[model samples]
Target chain A: MSEQQTVGFTVNGERHTVSVPTRELLVHTLRERLHLTGTHIGCDSSHCGACTVDLNGRSVKSCTVLTVQAQNAEVLTVEGLAGPDGLHPLQEGFREEHGLQCGFCTPGMLVRAYRFLQENPDPDEDQIRTGMAGNLCRCTGYQNIVKAIRYAAEKQTAGSV
Target chain B: MIPPSFAYRAPASLKEALALIDESGDDAKFLAGGHSLLPMMKFRVSEPAVLIDLGGVPELQGIREAGDRIHIGPMSTENEIIGSALLQQKCPLLPEVARWIADPQVRNRGTIGGDVAHGDPANDHPAVMLALEADFVLRSSQGERVVPANEFYFGTYFTAMEANEVLAEIRVPVLGPGTGYAYKKLKRKTGDFAIAAACVLLTLDRGICKRIAITLTNVGPTPLRASAAEQALTGKAIDDAAVENAAQLAMQICDPAEDLRGDKEYKTHMAGEMVRRAIRQALERAKEAK
Candidate 1:
């Protein structure tokens, strides 16, 4: 016997209402119920950033958060990063910089970097490294990943100007 | 890993939450930021039958000033504390320590109230609160009562808070002029728990210490206040010799258990080393404080 609850939240600017078990994590809801597989779940313990998402403008590990906790909150996953016009700057940067391999952690890394760039539009290399330390990548050694974020940062800065 | 099934209640108000806690009794647990509790739940280390979610309760949120003290809402997340301009100016030490907590994602959801109430010696806030001489306001059906930070922590995963009460607010006396504070944590990695950490808060009058508080983290069953060290530094110049002696005194109170971070001896030595560093940095900051 499992208790369930109805949770209403906004995802990628669209409203979602779902009934989930009380123990259902936001990552499971996003991937299983909502069918948004872009938000991967690597470390369910929340130590790994494979489930990172923007919850009400702040990055949070979705695996560690209950689905009910997102009630009425605005959540942004990796799938929401791009626009109708084209790929988001972060997406393009990752592509241009070859920022990933195996790509298991790319979705989370991209989503996390997307929010990171928003918080710090013109971060230096060290600042970027520190800011994105939460997200882990098994491949690429983080050198190119850092460059990818920097690439997006520069492009975004230019676009804003 | 899915957590054990539990009934969830998002109470609309603090009063409702308190009432729910009372009705549920020992089977209930107040869900704060969910960072600490959820992880434990996932591990099956905790299996509360009822979780009273405080998400919708507005009364348990915010950072405000009340006369001589600053009130930090129990639901205020670590990132909120790190970003609070008032706290940054009035009590910079909190923001400084908040930055060292886990990482961006964890900080976004980890509440200071949860960190302190969890009673984990490695959580950082308990020792920091002790050094700051903060107080916690607990709410229950009976009423509310304030518990000093030093007296609140009991043992690992234990606190003075009653089962029917929720930590409503944290009351910290606003650090005034001539006060210096620092939290020196020695963690193995970026988001790892501290091997040994020291939190130092001191008030300086000219070159002499008017008051000093030294506390150690992850070196005992609970956050250990270095009373002997604090007493030694009181009314004395914060020179290298004074800091050295105080650090040694602080080391004497450590009762650390061996963990992956290090052996007991290494943790004890790191406790003293961190205290020395924290005291020196606090003194530097104190001298600059207007």
Candidate 2:
């Protein structure tokens, strides 16, 4: 929707004032303008879930959201999951559990799983499956991703302890 | 997957959004949560010259229960509906339907208002709303009017909604005593669209149906109510024989088109089976409520 003016939003705690046409998707905005290529665009059609990100406080398919529509909204991409020289617990869990094979869908999966644990920290196997159903991973059977969430759960709880 | 270039305007109020739509005429489209419209826009399936964002319009969000009806604002997210205490207490059927909509992520962004106004027969809530005899409140620069759910949908991606109008709220009647409801869906995966779906709402008097409403989804250009099946169930005990007859009649009434999900025959048979299962579950739900 590039009709008249430019818009801006907060991404990964950074204020990004990018000039976008009124209809530019947030996924493209995060990838192209901001140079945060961590958010991949696999299937722009709300399917595939390759562009998953936390918008405001919830996980959402970035490809389906217009950049202008996200103006003044809080966006958390895959790049935002880490902090000074360390990985997020979900990232560590995926690495330790060998959750990636081809790694094409890893970013979205990681981000989605990150939010999944936040939404449901003590999720069971079935809960994890239902929670992350929107984010598909064809490369892996998700046996390990389920394990990864479990691993993160234990670590997160233990860390808090 | 960049959406084709279009001018964007985020309106501060319903009045402003409507005025923009009026000024831009047919070249403008309202973006409410943008779960459905933005995807279509990125695909170039719908390329409006201007995108009028409705997020700033404060009046278009929330759920309120008054008298015997539940009024849902146009911008209420599926998650919001699921979490709504008012709807959960009065119209539990809505939250049950909300739980299975798309996936958790899509549910966070997608609004029921957008879903109803989009008029996609394949979507779940339209059929659920129709089965509940929901009424849609439409507003424009002119004023506001209410259209019953059955009359709202016209055809594929079509509604009685005018180009300059916005759906203000959806009003659904709260079920009285002796009501039961169930929604049955068969999908390839958790997040995938439904292959076939069934929504049933029945009111029983001493274990015999006093009234029945059955609706089929993703099978036609509109959410179809199986009038013949409803007629068969009403004033009859919901026994095995009656359920079977009603299910079969509902299946017969449906002329499902062959899609990627299944052949027409398969969808038709599944529709019948879904009705049977939904009726059984709905009876149980009604029993629990009592």
Candidate 3:
């Protein structure tokens, strides 16, 4: 028997309430039910971080997380990165540094980097590599991805000052 | 890609969770971080009729000192353990070993209890716990019982924990002065399980090895405490020959199953290499401890 329940959570600052099967993964809930396709599911397994999203201020693999577990959780996706004033520094950094080749891993990378920077606002090159190690990018060999995160870190620091 | 349909129960208290599991019977599974269990569910390897999530249980959280031992909640995440100042000061081995478990995302949600109770030999915590001489606190409707790490694992995917019991807390003794430790894991990548890992804890008095505990990961059906290897180093001056003797003794007990990581011969050799490196590093740290 399939058990379903009402799960209420805020996605991108907007509260959402939906009834989903208890087995439904958080990635499917966001992409299929809510139509927030920004969070991609690369490896349905937790190995690939393409489905990464910020839950309660920490980046987690949405594909591995059950939707029911997100009850009353504040989730942040790639769509939530930008503000009314302009694009988030991470988005701008990706564009400026050519961080993407196929762009499939961009959303996960940006979202993870978004939280990672908060964890370490001004990280060194080694720190950025280690911090972003969870999210995998087949293309660009991670060279540009590292550069993109570094670029965002510098921009965020300058703006804060 | 998706887990089989199952009833989900989120109990707010430990008592409620225990009762729910007891009522659900054997088909019910306790959900911790869900990193290990969820993936198995997705692949249809495990089909639980009920999932009792302990995430809401307020009792299963935090790290604190209880007398001479450190009490660690099972729900404490790897990141939380890494960021814990108390753990860093009292038992630095835990935080050091936790950083090498998985990557950032998995570590954020992965719990120490899940890693310990999962009974997967590939998991790093079992060996570290064995080396640290830690104890597991299991609770159920009947009562609570403590199981030492060395006596916990019986074989692959099997442990001393009863089906109805919940891992309430883990108790590890605070490392005394002049103690040194290292967890040397050789993996394919950041998130990969160790091919053959060695966890070493040693104390040196003057130039002689005072006490030592050596444990190996993924080299047997269960985490193996290399008592023979420890015997080679204890009460002896750790030199090049003594270190080599311990490494060979550690390799003697390895019965690793052959897979993508390596053949049995290669894994056995790597296990020795890890022991060698860990002992050298641990010795250096022991000397530095003041």
Candidate 3 segments exceeding 4 Å error: none
iRMS per model, in Å, is 0.7, 2.1, 0.6
lDDT of 2 by residue, A85-136 (tens): 6998888999999988888889999889888888888899999988888888
DockQ of structure 2: 0.71
Off by over 4 Å in 1: none
DockQ for all candidate structures vs. native: 0.88, 0.71, 0.93
Question: What CAPRI class is candidate 1?
Answer: high
Q: What TM-score, to 2 decimal places, does chain A of model 2 have?
A: 0.95
lDDT of 1 by residue, B202-240 (tens): 889888999999999999999999999989999999888
Could you arrange the candidates by TM-score from highest to lowest? 3, 1, 2
* Per-residue lDDT over B51-80 for candidate 2, one digit per residue giving the tens place of the 0 to 100 score: 888888988987888889988888999999
Q: What is the lDDT of residue B113 in candidate 2?
A: 89
Model 1 clashing-pair count = 0
Q: Answer with 2 or 3, whichever has the higher TM-score.
A: 3
Residues B154-184, candidate 3: write the lDDT tens digits. 9999999999999999999899868999999
**Across residues A22-73, which tens digit of lDDT does each residue of candidate 3 receive?**
9999999999999999999898888879999999999999999999999999
